[model samples]
Target: MQALKGIAASNGIAIGKLKLCVKLDDKIAKKPITDVEAEIKRVESAKEEAEAALNRIYLDALKRVGEENSMIFQIHIMMLQDDDFFDAIKDCISDEKVNAEYAVWQAAQQFSTMFAQMDDEYMRARSADVVDISKRLLSCLDPNLDSGLDSLKEEAIVAASDLMPSETVQMDKSKVLAFVTEQGSKSSHSAILARTMSIPAVVGLCDAFSSLKDGAMTIVDGSAGDVIIEPDEATLKEYEQKRDAFLQHQKDLQLLKGTKAVTKSGVEMEINANIGHPSDVEMVLENDADGIGLFRSEFLYMESDDFPTEEQQFEAYKTVLEGMKGKRVIIRTLDLGADKQVPYLNIPKEENPAMGYRAIRISLDRKELFVTQLRALVRASAFGKLAIMFPMITSVEQVKEIKELLNQVKADLKAEGVAFAPDFEIGIMIETPASVILSDLLAKEVDFFSVGTNDLTQYTLAVDRMNPQISSMYDPRHPAVLRMIQMAAENAKKAGIWIGICGESAGDTELTRFYVDIGINELSVTPGTVLELRRTVQQLD
Candidate 1:
């Protein structure tokens, strides 16, 4: 057994023969392209293959997980079909006169590379998207090639250069457990998916691709972020026992499916769903979620053309709130900008779209944009319990400004005598390091704080996710990030404000105990993880 250490992208444990899944990116990069037509053909072929593979993935997910679960593919589907992407590839082929494969890939690399080089790390990390597209092309061109994952019959560790959201989602969530990425990060979508799938995975293993050969005995610890190769008997036995214990614990915890999430000390911790659409509310109910902790209303903006009117917003909020009944709901207002290009919102093109107008900042700049949402939330609150929260807040003054606007919106609503929730709590997301450092000050002014760990970790570490070069450095367990979360939680506590986590870290089962230890008041997670998360928290006290 050969052992190689790299960054752990996803957290999960798997013991299986190494089913080497080499990324064909290097191969695509090496392929020679002589003309623009060849490049176009290659690009089109990749798109077609991506479509077919993605469709298979969707079908596979639906076949295994269910249709609703498969809807996650919508964006991936759109990416393959998006005219912007095609146009980019076309321009590359036409201008560069390269083979179709190289044209699409070269264009994608250039496009993502520009964003990846931005001063804002969060925006820069977006270059993985280009790699994602390139992977689709590679996967498409090599139609007859084996998935590599399919050949593994016995329990074995899986190896890949890195994983994509679509590829990971299509992965057999059960049989081949755990992740070992030669390249990637803990913040990658692969990591997020591993957590969601409850599979232990480790990423950023630098030599995982070049070192580990097929059929190697691999051992990994999802919790400690440890992996051992050619483990001696003791190591193998220890992991086996640990794996079994975890499996049993999982069975026992599911019994808490409908039970209230209380610590052993009997403190109630709100276990809610972090959802994107009103339609997902039923999923919350089905999964027995306590309520909506992070209701991302951004989906409404993403799906609509024009700014969603107060009525449109009200109807959507009503559906979500109505579904949750009297349960508490914390709704995050529209978060859109260059990254989330909605046809309706005519947002200007920016070189660094991620750092450009986005999240609450955008809404605040365009008061009408935010006011419309505020009115809808107020109106919907009248019918159900609601807590409103802002996203991407980086300044204390922004909090105060929102308070003033809330007052004005309230006064306007009262003057109009519109039936609205008489009272609503206001909160802001702590996503930037600036906000994290000043969380105590901001906490005093807001009703609650939801740490957007996704952005927090990205901005804090300065790791551009799209550029796989430095992506290895981005880790949630990095002492610096842990300290930040600890400090923010402490400040929020000092300020006497309830604190919740809504980013990728919130729903993490392994991290639940860590959050509980650090004084997290609530955890807003995906609906599917609610039951397991409740169980994880139940163990804390």
Candidate 2:
């Protein structure tokens, strides 16, 4: 038996023979494409195969993960059918004089390079489609090349040197069990797809996975970050007992669903989810949350050439409100900067992007973009409960500017005879130290406050989030972070404004009593966390 510790990406357990997914390194092909028309025909055939594979996964996934979510394959479909993609192939086949398969694959390689350099996460995911298309093209061009998918016939744990999102789409449903990837992380598309499929997964185990030969007896406990290869009798028995206990625990968690978030004394505490997309409405509804507390609206802006218009914003917000059936949905205006630079805005390169122009700073500078989102939020308000919050508010001046813009938006709507909620609550995320320390005065002006502990801790500690050297210092449990959160809550309590916690600390059960003790009423977290939070709140006296 061998043990290796790594960042636990997903939580689950599995015991099956390991199935390794080898990532072929990008290298020059032996038999390259040499004809132009032949390359086009070859590309067409590869795409057809990819489309069929995608359809197969979509059909199988619809049985378990619903049609709405299993549609990640469509992203690949769009890539395969892209027009510019075919043009690039023509250029490559005509100029490069390579074999038809190699020509299309070469063109895809260029596209892959372009995607890999992009800063956005969703765009980065498209790199997988490029690789998938290329590999599929190469396989079709030469009938002799091996895809190594024959391993799926046996019941084994799926292992990959690196699995892209599209590659995992048509994964073996019954024969393949869990996933172990040398590349990617929890947030990576490969791991996310594995988790959604209810398959146990472990990533960042560079060379540890391959040490176990194919068909070797293995036990992968993703929850505890364990991988046992050739386990002894005692080890096998221990895991068997553990696996049985985990099954029962899952059953217990299922019972917690739909139960109102109440304390031991029946104190009805507000616990809501922080969603990123309109699709997350289903998650909140499924979790039976009190309402939507924080909707990180940055997602809409990231994948666009220009800012989202009022109509598009209104439609997205309307979907969420209708889905929640009149439940409260708080949407934060585009909170982006270095980590989330808007391609349209052209943010300058910064040594530390985390501290650079981000959140409210960018929105305030681009007032038109800010107003558009506000107008949408106001219009969405007529459909159901709605509240708007600003992010990265460091000074009272910033809040005043936002207030003025909100007023201007409301005035314009009224002037145009557009029906919208006349009066709406305006709040700011207390992310910076300046906001937290001066929460008392700021609380009087804003309707409410939400402490964003992730940034709060980073700024207080003066550590850049992306800098690996100082990553070990990012402890939300640090006394400084606790003090700021407590201070913000206390100040908000004194001023009689509703205070919330939307940061990762809000979901921490160990700090639940402490947060409640400090006078925080609303807790906003990921939807998957609501049940455990409800249990914790139930235990709170």
Candidate 3:
């Protein structure tokens, strides 16, 4: 028996045969080109074909997953059409006079190298996008290349060096029981998609288990981040028992659905879901979520070719609001820039984007974009209980600016005779250390505060949580982070405004009791954790 350790990305277990999916070897030989114009034409034609393929993938992904998840394909399409990307390829073809395939490959390598050398892990991960687009263009130029993941005869544990978003989206999901990657992290696209699909996944194996033969019997313990190849009889039996117990535990957690999230001492707290798109409402209702505490509204903007119109944004908000059936839904306005980039926004490149032009800062500066979203949210508010929250807020001035624009939007809507809820609530996300310290002053201006502990912890600890190298230091349970949360919670209490945690820390069961003890009014987590969080609340004294 051979055992390999990896990062536990998704929580589950699968016992199945191994299917080694080696990426297609698309190495192209450079050849002197007689006609540089012909090479440029060929590259352009291949780009057009790649665009068509990506559009098809985007549509398919939209139908399968919601627009939020489907935006990855759209972003891929944008990368293909990017002026810089196209210029690089054209420059290679014109200046180097190389074959179209080699030129594309060289251009891709240049951009990939740039991203890989970045200090930020998220930006570094973008190298995969450049590689994926290059591979697609290469495949378009040479049709013989095979990805090997498109065809699967039976359910098996897929092993690969790594998976790009396009490749993961195109694979036969039913045949893929689990995934083991030699290179990846929890924030990788494959990991994110695996969690969304509720499939077992273990990444960052780093070539340790790459020698395992194809079709070998394997046990993937995703919860423990262990991949066992050709396990002995005794070991297999032990895993079988453990898998059964885990499955049974999942079944038992379902009974907690529809139950109140009240503590044993009669302290009732709201248990909400953090959703990315409208389709997530189904999972929220299935898990009996109190409401959506964070409806990420950036997907609409990201998926579209241009800015999302007010009606488009309104329909999305309306869908979630109507589906929740009067339950409170907090829609955060366009948290763009930073890690999440929209090319058309023309946000200048920054050395450190996380602390740069992003979230509320962008909205405050781009009043028209901010107003468009506000108008839609206000219009949708009339359908059900809807509240708007601003992200990355660090000062009273930002909050004041947002309120002024919101008032303008409300006045414009009222003058136009548009029906909207006049009393809709406004809140600010307490993410930065400054926000935590100034919580008292900010609380007086907003209806409530939702501590975005993900950023709060990162900024407070001076650690980038996505950077695997220093990820160990990015602990939410750190004394400084806890103190900030406590300070925010206490300030909200004094101001008579509710405060909730809508970050990954909210789902940490080990900290549930501490959150309760600190008087956190709400805990907004992913839908899968809603019942578990409710169970934790129930057991809290």
lDDT of 2 by residue, 1-541 (tens): 7765544555677776776554444433635544567666776776687677666665555444433234455455556678888788777777766666556666777898887666643455466568776665566566444355533677788776767665565566576667777756554556656655656777767667557566677788877667778788898898888878877776677688778777887667789987777766777888778998898786566545587788988998888877888778888888777445545677876655677687788778877777888888888888877888888887888888788888888888888988877666788899989999889989988889988887898788875333323444667889988998888988998999999998867887889988877878899987777877888898889
lDDT of 1 at 143: 53
Distance (Å) between predicted and true CA of 250, model 3?
2.4
Clashing pairs in 3: none
Q: Please, what is the whole-model Cα lDDT of each candidate in the order they appear? A: 0.73, 0.73, 0.85
Scanning candidate 1 in windows of ten residues, the lowest lDDT window is: 62-71
Best by TM-score: 3
Candidate that scores best on lDDT: 3
Tens digits of per-residue lDDT, candidate 1, 1-541, equal 4455665544445676667775565555434445667567766767877777776775565434333234445446656677877898788768766656566667677767786777665556556666666666755666543355644566667778777666677566556767677766665667766765667887776754576776777777766667677788887888898888877876776677779878787777788887766767777787888888888776666545467788989998888788788999898887776456665566776766666788877888899888988888888988788999988888888888988898898899889988877767788888888888888788889888888886788788876554556765756667787788889889988888888888767766767778878888888877777888787767776
| TM-score of every candidate relative to the true structure | 0.77, 0.74, 0.90
Count: clashes, candidate 1: 30
Better of 2 and 3 by TM-score: 3
What candidate 3 gets wrong by more than 4 Å, as runs, is 23-42, 58-74, 83-103, 119-122, 471-473
